[model samples]
Target: MYKFKILIEGYARTGANGVYFASPTSSLIYDEKVKVLVDPGTNADALRSSFEREEMEFKDIDIVFLTHYHPDHFLNIRLFPNVDLYDGTTRWHGDQEHFYEGRLPGTDIELVPTPGHTMEQTSLVIETVEYGIVFVCQDVFWWEDGKQKSDNVNDLLNNPDPFMASWKDLQNSRKIVLDRADWIVPGHGKMFRNPRRN
Candidate 1:
Protein backbone atom coordinates (compact mmCIF):
# COMPACT_ATOMS: atom_id res chain seq x y z
CA MET A 1 0.00 0.00 0.00
CA TYR A 2 1.14 3.55 -0.67
CA LYS A 3 1.21 6.58 1.59
CA PHE A 4 -0.04 9.93 0.36
CA LYS A 5 0.24 13.48 1.68
CA ILE A 6 -1.07 16.84 0.54
CA LEU A 7 1.84 19.21 0.35
CA ILE A 8 -0.24 22.19 -0.74
CA GLU A 9 -3.95 22.90 -0.48
CA GLY A 10 -4.99 25.34 -3.19
CA TYR A 11 -7.57 28.11 -2.88
CA ALA A 12 -10.37 29.60 -4.97
CA ARG A 13 -11.90 33.04 -5.41
CA THR A 14 -14.92 34.05 -7.40
CA GLY A 15 -14.31 36.34 -10.33
CA ALA A 16 -16.52 39.08 -11.88
CA ASN A 17 -18.01 36.48 -14.20
CA GLY A 18 -19.18 34.49 -11.15
CA VAL A 19 -16.75 31.69 -11.98
CA TYR A 20 -14.36 30.57 -9.31
CA PHE A 21 -10.67 31.01 -10.00
CA ALA A 22 -8.67 28.17 -8.47
CA SER A 23 -5.10 27.61 -7.48
CA PRO A 24 -3.30 24.31 -8.08
CA THR A 25 -2.93 21.67 -5.43
CA SER A 26 0.24 19.61 -4.99
CA SER A 27 0.77 16.27 -3.29
CA LEU A 28 3.22 13.45 -2.73
CA ILE A 29 2.73 9.71 -2.78
CA TYR A 30 5.25 7.10 -1.80
CA ASP A 31 5.93 3.76 -0.26
CA GLU A 32 9.00 1.66 0.45
CA LYS A 33 9.84 1.60 -3.25
CA VAL A 34 8.07 4.39 -5.11
CA LYS A 35 8.16 8.15 -4.64
CA VAL A 36 5.90 10.33 -6.77
CA LEU A 37 5.10 14.04 -6.69
CA VAL A 38 1.82 15.24 -8.20
CA ASP A 39 1.37 18.72 -9.68
CA PRO A 40 4.12 21.02 -8.51
CA GLY A 41 2.36 24.40 -8.62
CA THR A 42 3.63 27.90 -9.55
CA ASN A 43 5.36 28.50 -6.25
CA ALA A 44 8.76 26.86 -6.12
CA ASP A 45 9.62 28.19 -2.68
CA ALA A 46 6.43 26.85 -1.18
CA LEU A 47 7.14 23.45 -2.71
CA ARG A 48 10.66 23.55 -1.38
CA SER A 49 9.36 24.36 2.09
CA SER A 50 6.91 21.48 1.85
CA PHE A 51 9.71 19.11 0.90
CA GLU A 52 11.78 20.29 3.82
CA ARG A 53 8.86 19.84 6.19
CA GLU A 54 8.46 16.29 4.95
CA GLU A 55 12.16 15.61 5.45
CA MET A 56 12.76 15.31 1.73
CA GLU A 57 14.59 17.25 -0.94
CA PHE A 58 14.17 17.91 -4.67
CA LYS A 59 16.46 14.96 -5.42
CA ASP A 60 14.09 12.58 -3.65
CA ILE A 61 11.28 12.89 -6.16
CA ASP A 62 11.14 9.80 -8.40
CA ILE A 63 8.24 10.71 -10.66
CA VAL A 64 6.25 13.82 -11.51
CA PHE A 65 2.67 13.69 -12.75
CA LEU A 66 0.96 16.79 -14.09
CA THR A 67 -2.83 16.76 -14.34
CA HIS A 68 -2.65 19.32 -17.15
CA TYR A 69 -0.51 22.05 -18.64
CA HIS A 70 -2.20 24.97 -16.89
CA PRO A 71 0.27 27.51 -15.59
CA ASP A 72 -0.89 27.20 -12.00
CA HIS A 73 -0.51 23.44 -12.11
CA PHE A 74 2.50 22.78 -14.33
CA LEU A 75 4.64 25.87 -14.61
CA ASN A 76 6.96 24.80 -11.82
CA ILE A 77 7.98 21.52 -13.47
CA ARG A 78 11.51 22.83 -13.86
CA LEU A 79 11.89 22.41 -10.09
CA PHE A 80 12.31 18.68 -10.59
CA PRO A 81 14.47 18.33 -13.68
CA ASN A 82 15.86 14.84 -13.16
CA VAL A 83 12.64 12.93 -12.59
CA ASP A 84 10.38 11.36 -15.19
CA LEU A 85 7.32 13.50 -15.98
CA TYR A 86 3.95 12.40 -17.36
CA ASP A 87 1.00 14.41 -18.63
CA GLY A 88 -0.47 12.28 -21.46
CA THR A 89 0.21 14.95 -24.08
CA THR A 90 2.77 15.22 -26.87
CA ARG A 91 4.51 18.48 -26.17
CA TRP A 92 8.14 19.47 -26.21
CA HIS A 93 9.91 20.63 -23.07
CA GLY A 94 13.37 21.87 -23.90
CA ASP A 95 13.53 19.78 -27.09
CA GLN A 96 12.49 16.57 -25.24
CA GLU A 97 8.96 15.28 -24.86
CA HIS A 98 8.07 13.03 -21.91
CA PHE A 99 4.51 12.11 -22.72
CA TYR A 100 2.82 9.26 -20.89
CA GLU A 101 -0.72 8.21 -20.05
CA GLY A 102 -2.77 5.25 -18.74
CA ARG A 103 -1.20 3.37 -15.84
CA LEU A 104 2.11 5.08 -15.14
CA PRO A 105 4.84 2.86 -16.70
CA GLY A 106 6.27 1.12 -13.64
CA THR A 107 3.68 1.79 -10.95
CA ASP A 108 0.08 0.91 -10.10
CA ILE A 109 -1.00 4.55 -10.31
CA GLU A 110 -3.50 4.96 -13.14
CA LEU A 111 -3.74 8.15 -15.21
CA VAL A 112 -7.28 8.71 -16.42
CA PRO A 113 -8.05 11.49 -18.91
CA THR A 114 -10.40 13.96 -17.21
CA PRO A 115 -10.63 16.76 -19.69
CA GLY A 116 -13.04 19.59 -18.87
CA HIS A 117 -10.83 22.18 -17.36
CA THR A 118 -8.71 21.62 -20.43
CA MET A 119 -8.71 19.24 -23.38
CA GLU A 120 -5.56 17.49 -22.19
CA GLN A 121 -6.33 17.24 -18.48
CA THR A 122 -5.73 13.96 -16.64
CA SER A 123 -6.61 12.57 -13.21
CA LEU A 124 -4.94 9.89 -11.09
CA VAL A 125 -6.15 6.84 -9.20
CA ILE A 126 -4.01 4.86 -6.81
CA GLU A 127 -4.72 2.24 -4.14
CA THR A 128 -3.46 2.93 -0.67
CA VAL A 129 -3.31 1.05 2.61
CA GLU A 130 -5.44 3.67 4.35
CA TYR A 131 -7.75 4.44 1.45
CA GLY A 132 -8.64 1.73 -1.00
CA ILE A 133 -8.87 3.92 -4.14
CA VAL A 134 -7.75 7.50 -3.89
CA PHE A 135 -8.30 9.83 -6.84
CA VAL A 136 -6.20 12.92 -7.34
CA CYS A 137 -8.31 14.94 -9.72
CA GLN A 138 -7.21 18.34 -10.95
CA ASP A 139 -9.92 20.83 -11.89
CA VAL A 140 -12.33 18.04 -12.80
CA PHE A 141 -14.45 19.66 -10.08
CA TRP A 142 -14.11 22.07 -7.20
CA TRP A 143 -15.57 22.55 -3.72
CA GLU A 144 -17.40 25.67 -2.56
CA ASP A 145 -19.10 26.33 0.78
CA GLY A 146 -18.27 22.72 1.67
CA LYS A 147 -20.20 21.39 -1.31
CA GLN A 148 -18.78 19.92 -4.50
CA LYS A 149 -19.48 22.22 -7.44
CA SER A 150 -19.06 21.97 -11.20
CA ASP A 151 -19.26 25.63 -12.10
CA ASN A 152 -16.54 25.21 -14.65
CA VAL A 153 -18.62 22.78 -16.67
CA ASN A 154 -21.61 25.08 -16.57
CA ASP A 155 -19.49 28.04 -17.58
CA LEU A 156 -18.03 26.19 -20.53
CA LEU A 157 -21.43 24.98 -21.70
CA ASN A 158 -23.40 28.17 -21.17
CA ASN A 159 -20.86 30.60 -22.47
CA PRO A 160 -21.14 31.59 -26.15
CA ASP A 161 -17.42 31.20 -26.71
CA PRO A 162 -16.97 28.85 -29.67
CA PHE A 163 -13.45 27.98 -28.61
CA MET A 164 -14.57 25.88 -25.63
CA ALA A 165 -14.80 22.22 -26.47
CA SER A 166 -17.71 19.90 -25.77
CA TRP A 167 -18.95 20.02 -22.19
CA LYS A 168 -20.39 16.53 -22.67
CA ASP A 169 -16.88 15.11 -22.62
CA LEU A 170 -16.24 16.75 -19.26
CA GLN A 171 -19.53 15.47 -17.84
CA ASN A 172 -18.61 11.95 -18.91
CA SER A 173 -15.21 12.37 -17.30
CA ARG A 174 -16.78 13.50 -14.02
CA LYS A 175 -19.05 10.46 -14.13
CA ILE A 176 -15.99 8.28 -14.51
CA VAL A 177 -14.42 9.81 -11.41
CA LEU A 178 -17.61 9.63 -9.32
CA ASP A 179 -18.26 6.03 -10.31
CA ARG A 180 -14.73 4.83 -9.53
CA ALA A 181 -13.16 6.95 -6.86
CA ASP A 182 -13.55 6.00 -3.20
CA TRP A 183 -11.86 9.17 -1.99
CA ILE A 184 -11.16 12.34 -3.94
CA VAL A 185 -8.48 14.99 -3.64
CA PRO A 186 -9.63 17.92 -5.71
CA GLY A 187 -7.38 20.47 -7.41
CA HIS A 188 -8.53 23.13 -4.98
CA GLY A 189 -9.86 22.87 -1.42
CA LYS A 190 -9.78 19.89 0.92
CA MET A 191 -9.76 16.17 0.24
CA PHE A 192 -13.17 14.57 0.65
CA ARG A 193 -14.82 11.16 0.56
CA ASN A 194 -17.25 10.01 -2.11
CA PRO A 195 -20.42 11.28 -0.45
CA ARG A 196 -22.57 9.22 -2.78
CA ARG A 197 -21.11 6.01 -1.38
CA ASN A 198 -21.03 7.13 2.20
Candidate 2:
Protein backbone atom coordinates (compact mmCIF):
# COMPACT_ATOMS: atom_id res chain seq x y z
CA MET A 1 0.00 0.00 0.00
CA TYR A 2 1.03 3.58 -0.67
CA LYS A 3 0.47 6.80 1.22
CA PHE A 4 0.33 10.30 -0.25
CA LYS A 5 0.42 13.84 1.07
CA ILE A 6 -0.13 17.23 -0.49
CA LEU A 7 3.03 19.25 -0.14
CA ILE A 8 1.51 22.48 -1.41
CA GLU A 9 -1.98 23.54 -2.25
CA GLY A 10 -1.99 25.64 -5.44
CA TYR A 11 -3.54 29.07 -5.81
CA ALA A 12 -4.58 31.60 -8.45
CA ARG A 13 -4.04 35.27 -9.14
CA THR A 14 -5.72 37.74 -11.44
CA GLY A 15 -3.78 39.37 -14.26
CA ALA A 16 -4.39 41.57 -17.25
CA ASN A 17 -4.95 38.44 -19.30
CA GLY A 18 -7.63 37.43 -16.78
CA VAL A 19 -7.22 34.87 -14.00
CA TYR A 20 -3.70 33.47 -14.02
CA PHE A 21 -3.36 30.61 -11.57
CA ALA A 22 -0.01 28.99 -12.26
CA SER A 23 0.94 28.10 -8.71
CA PRO A 24 1.77 24.41 -8.92
CA THR A 25 0.09 21.88 -6.65
CA SER A 26 2.64 19.34 -5.48
CA SER A 27 2.33 16.02 -3.68
CA LEU A 28 4.45 13.18 -2.39
CA ILE A 29 3.70 9.48 -2.74
CA TYR A 30 5.70 6.93 -0.86
CA ASP A 31 5.65 3.33 0.32
CA GLU A 32 8.75 1.56 1.59
CA LYS A 33 10.94 1.51 -1.54
CA VAL A 34 9.59 4.36 -3.68
CA LYS A 35 9.25 8.03 -2.80
CA VAL A 36 7.82 9.95 -5.73
CA LEU A 37 7.08 13.66 -6.01
CA VAL A 38 4.45 15.05 -8.29
CA ASP A 39 4.84 18.61 -9.66
CA PRO A 40 7.30 20.33 -7.33
CA GLY A 41 6.08 23.85 -8.32
CA THR A 42 7.96 27.16 -8.95
CA ASN A 43 8.79 28.30 -5.43
CA ALA A 44 11.93 26.66 -4.10
CA ASP A 45 11.59 28.16 -0.64
CA ALA A 46 7.99 27.05 -0.23
CA LEU A 47 8.84 23.58 -1.48
CA ARG A 48 11.74 23.33 0.94
CA SER A 49 9.58 24.51 3.82
CA SER A 50 6.95 21.96 2.96
CA PHE A 51 9.56 19.22 2.99
CA GLU A 52 10.77 20.36 6.39
CA ARG A 53 7.23 20.42 7.73
CA GLU A 54 6.77 16.86 6.57
CA GLU A 55 10.05 15.84 8.19
CA MET A 56 11.56 15.12 4.82
CA GLU A 57 14.50 16.36 2.76
CA PHE A 58 15.61 16.43 -0.86
CA LYS A 59 17.62 13.26 -0.32
CA ASP A 60 14.42 11.37 0.46
CA ILE A 61 12.95 11.88 -2.98
CA ASP A 62 13.35 8.92 -5.31
CA ILE A 63 11.50 10.11 -8.44
CA VAL A 64 9.89 13.22 -9.89
CA PHE A 65 6.79 13.25 -12.03
CA LEU A 66 5.89 16.39 -13.90
CA THR A 67 2.29 16.72 -15.02
CA HIS A 68 3.31 19.06 -17.84
CA TYR A 69 6.00 21.46 -19.04
CA HIS A 70 4.42 24.54 -17.49
CA PRO A 71 6.99 26.50 -15.51
CA ASP A 72 4.88 26.49 -12.37
CA HIS A 73 4.81 22.70 -12.32
CA PHE A 74 8.23 21.68 -13.66
CA LEU A 75 10.61 24.49 -12.76
CA ASN A 76 12.02 23.22 -9.44
CA ILE A 77 12.84 19.78 -10.84
CA ARG A 78 16.55 20.51 -10.59
CA LEU A 79 16.39 20.13 -6.79
CA PHE A 80 16.10 16.36 -7.08
CA PRO A 81 19.04 15.27 -9.21
CA ASN A 82 19.43 11.75 -7.82
CA VAL A 83 16.04 10.55 -9.00
CA ASP A 84 14.55 9.61 -12.33
CA LEU A 85 12.18 12.20 -13.82
CA TYR A 86 9.16 11.90 -16.07
CA ASP A 87 7.19 14.62 -17.83
CA GLY A 88 3.90 14.82 -19.64
CA THR A 89 5.67 15.46 -22.92
CA THR A 90 8.85 14.35 -24.64
CA ARG A 91 11.59 16.91 -24.33
CA TRP A 92 15.25 17.09 -23.47
CA HIS A 93 17.54 19.33 -21.43
CA GLY A 94 21.19 18.37 -21.67
CA ASP A 95 21.41 14.82 -20.28
CA GLN A 96 17.97 15.01 -18.63
CA GLU A 97 15.13 13.79 -20.80
CA HIS A 98 11.41 14.17 -20.00
CA PHE A 99 9.46 11.05 -20.76
CA TYR A 100 6.44 11.44 -23.02
CA GLU A 101 4.57 8.42 -21.64
CA GLY A 102 5.20 5.29 -19.56
CA ARG A 103 4.56 3.56 -16.21
CA LEU A 104 6.88 3.83 -13.23
CA PRO A 105 8.13 0.25 -13.66
CA GLY A 106 7.08 -1.43 -10.38
CA THR A 107 4.61 1.13 -9.06
CA ASP A 108 0.82 1.00 -9.04
CA ILE A 109 0.69 4.59 -10.24
CA GLU A 110 -0.29 4.71 -13.91
CA LEU A 111 0.76 7.73 -15.96
CA VAL A 112 -2.33 8.20 -18.03
CA PRO A 113 -2.57 10.71 -20.85
CA THR A 114 -4.98 13.45 -19.83
CA PRO A 115 -4.45 16.10 -22.42
CA GLY A 116 -6.66 19.18 -22.99
CA HIS A 117 -5.24 21.45 -20.32
CA THR A 118 -2.32 21.22 -22.71
CA MET A 119 -1.44 18.80 -25.48
CA GLU A 120 1.18 17.29 -23.23
CA GLN A 121 -0.62 17.29 -19.88
CA THR A 122 -0.82 13.95 -18.06
CA SER A 123 -2.58 12.73 -14.90
CA LEU A 124 -1.84 9.86 -12.57
CA VAL A 125 -4.22 7.19 -11.33
CA ILE A 126 -2.70 5.81 -8.15
CA GLU A 127 -4.26 2.64 -6.83
CA THR A 128 -4.01 2.80 -3.06
CA VAL A 129 -5.30 0.30 -0.57
CA GLU A 130 -6.55 3.01 1.77
CA TYR A 131 -7.95 5.45 -0.78
CA GLY A 132 -9.12 3.14 -3.53
CA ILE A 133 -8.05 5.17 -6.62
CA VAL A 134 -6.76 8.66 -6.21
CA PHE A 135 -6.34 10.84 -9.30
CA VAL A 136 -3.73 13.53 -9.38
CA CYS A 137 -4.98 15.71 -12.20
CA GLN A 138 -3.13 18.99 -12.40
CA ASP A 139 -4.89 21.76 -14.30
CA VAL A 140 -7.29 19.25 -15.79
CA PHE A 141 -9.83 20.80 -13.44
CA TRP A 142 -9.30 23.89 -11.40
CA TRP A 143 -10.81 24.21 -7.93
CA GLU A 144 -11.61 27.79 -7.11
CA ASP A 145 -13.61 29.58 -4.38
CA GLY A 146 -15.43 26.41 -3.32
CA LYS A 147 -16.42 24.93 -6.64
CA GLN A 148 -14.79 22.87 -9.35
CA LYS A 149 -14.37 24.65 -12.65
CA SER A 150 -13.17 23.62 -16.07
CA ASP A 151 -10.97 26.66 -16.58
CA ASN A 152 -8.80 24.94 -19.14
CA VAL A 153 -11.79 24.22 -21.32
CA ASN A 154 -12.97 27.78 -20.89
CA ASP A 155 -9.57 29.03 -22.01
CA LEU A 156 -9.57 26.84 -25.07
CA LEU A 157 -13.13 27.67 -26.04
CA ASN A 158 -12.81 31.43 -25.52
CA ASN A 159 -9.60 31.79 -27.47
CA PRO A 160 -9.91 32.74 -31.12
CA ASP A 161 -7.20 30.25 -32.01
CA PRO A 162 -7.20 27.29 -29.65
CA PHE A 163 -3.95 25.58 -30.50
CA MET A 164 -3.04 23.73 -27.32
CA ALA A 165 -6.26 21.85 -26.66
CA SER A 166 -9.61 20.80 -28.06
CA TRP A 167 -13.04 20.94 -26.46
CA LYS A 168 -13.88 17.35 -27.31
CA ASP A 169 -10.62 16.04 -25.95
CA LEU A 170 -11.06 17.98 -22.69
CA GLN A 171 -14.58 16.59 -22.24
CA ASN A 172 -13.35 13.10 -22.93
CA SER A 173 -10.54 13.46 -20.43
CA ARG A 174 -12.98 14.68 -17.77
CA LYS A 175 -15.14 11.62 -18.31
CA ILE A 176 -12.15 9.37 -18.00
CA VAL A 177 -11.06 10.93 -14.71
CA LEU A 178 -14.57 11.02 -13.28
CA ASP A 179 -15.03 7.40 -14.21
CA ARG A 180 -11.86 6.17 -12.58
CA ALA A 181 -11.19 8.49 -9.70
CA ASP A 182 -12.82 8.07 -6.30
CA TRP A 183 -10.93 11.03 -4.94
CA ILE A 184 -9.37 14.01 -6.73
CA VAL A 185 -6.44 16.20 -5.93
CA PRO A 186 -6.69 19.09 -8.32
CA GLY A 187 -4.06 21.61 -9.36
CA HIS A 188 -5.40 24.57 -7.41
CA GLY A 189 -7.28 23.36 -4.37
CA LYS A 190 -7.58 20.96 -1.48
CA MET A 191 -8.18 17.26 -1.97
CA PHE A 192 -11.85 16.36 -2.20
CA ARG A 193 -14.03 13.32 -2.42
CA ASN A 194 -15.20 13.03 -6.04
CA PRO A 195 -18.93 13.80 -5.97
CA ARG A 196 -19.53 12.41 -9.45
CA ARG A 197 -19.29 8.88 -8.24
CA ASN A 198 -22.30 6.77 -7.19
Candidate 1 structure quality by residue, lDDT tens digits, 17-122 = 7976556779998988878888998778788899889999888888787888777788888887766677755334566985655677677878788876678887
TM-score of every model versus the real structure: 0.80, 0.80
TM-score for candidate 1: 0.80
Least accurate stretch of 10 residues (summed lDDT) in model 2?
154-163
- Tens-digit per-residue lDDT, 1-198, candidate 2: 689888998865566768565576899988998988999998788899999999998988877888877787888888876667766554345587655456665577788898877877889888777777899987777645445443343432332222346667766777788778888887776676666653
14 Cα displacement, candidate 1 (Å): 6.9
TM-score of 2: 0.80
lDDT of 2: 0.74
